[model samples]
Target: MAKKQTKDQALANNRRASFNYLIGETYEAGIQLTGTEIKSVRLGQITIGDAYVTIRNGQAYLNNANISPYKQGNQFNSDPLRRRKLLLHKREIAALDEAVMQGGKTIVPLRVYLVKGFAKILIAIGTGKKNYDKRQTIKERDMQRELGKNLKNYH
Candidate 1:
């Protein structure tokens, strides 16, 4: 059997998303990309840090995601920052739209990875975290690190 890959081996991850937003439900969506875009992604030249998802006309689109042009793609390369369409079911789109409209939630890209040789994106609904919430997160993380260090020393 082949070894299974984990989500941490993603091509690109928005590390700040967790600190800045209280992430809710997450969904895996397929991305429509061109040949050169996929080449760039395979090279690990993508950034989802500032990418966001928006639903329009019942379709979800990824915006502001930067996939650097392939070095050897020449004229075949498309715009690096072009908006890419997300492939999601009609029911998923409807639910996401409703959540955004009624729950005041935002959709953000969490990570991008290749699954079964296809490019996929992980997106999540999130509520923006306040300044104090961010501080608390930092404090908790620090405490966890300290506790781990002490435990390691005792062991």
Candidate 2:
């Protein structure tokens, strides 16, 4: 028997989004990819550093995401930077629309990955953290790290 191969090949992740926002809930959404776009993504040549999600007309879409064109795609290459539509359920889109309508809440793309040979995007409903809130999170993380170190020393 042959080993089954997995289509992981994570294109990109927005690590800073976690620190800057209080993520309330996460949802997985499918992205509409062109032929060249999928090829470029599979090659792990994409970036989501400045990507964000927005709910408009009961649909969620990605903005400011960049997927590098395939090297040999030639005339068939896709736009390196373009707005891509994200597929989500109707109820999910309504919920996202409501959350984003709140004062400081936003929809942000956390990471882009492939699953079962299909591309998937993880979206988070987040609230922008104030400066003090960010500092508190940092302090808590530091404390947790210190506690782990102390526990290891005791053992």
| Per-model TM against the reference | 0.93, 0.86
Q: Mind giving the per-residue lDDT tens digits that candidate 2 earns over 1-155?
A: 63332544456889889899988899999999899898888777888988898777777889998999898899998678888899889989988898887768889888888887678899999888999998998999999999999999999
Q: Candidate 2: lDDT of 70?
A: 90
* Model 2: per-residue Cα lDDT at residue 68: 90
What would the per-residue lDDT of candidate 1 be over residues 29-66, giving only the tens digit for each residue?
99999999998887789999989999999999999999
> Given candidate 2, what's the lDDT at residue 118?
74
- TM-score of model 2 (CA atoms): 0.86
Model 1 bad stretches (over 4 Å): 1-8
Task: Score residue 105 of candidate 1 by CA lDDT.
Answer: 84
- CA RMSD of all predictions: 2.2, 2.6
Best by lDDT: 1
Best by TM-score: 1
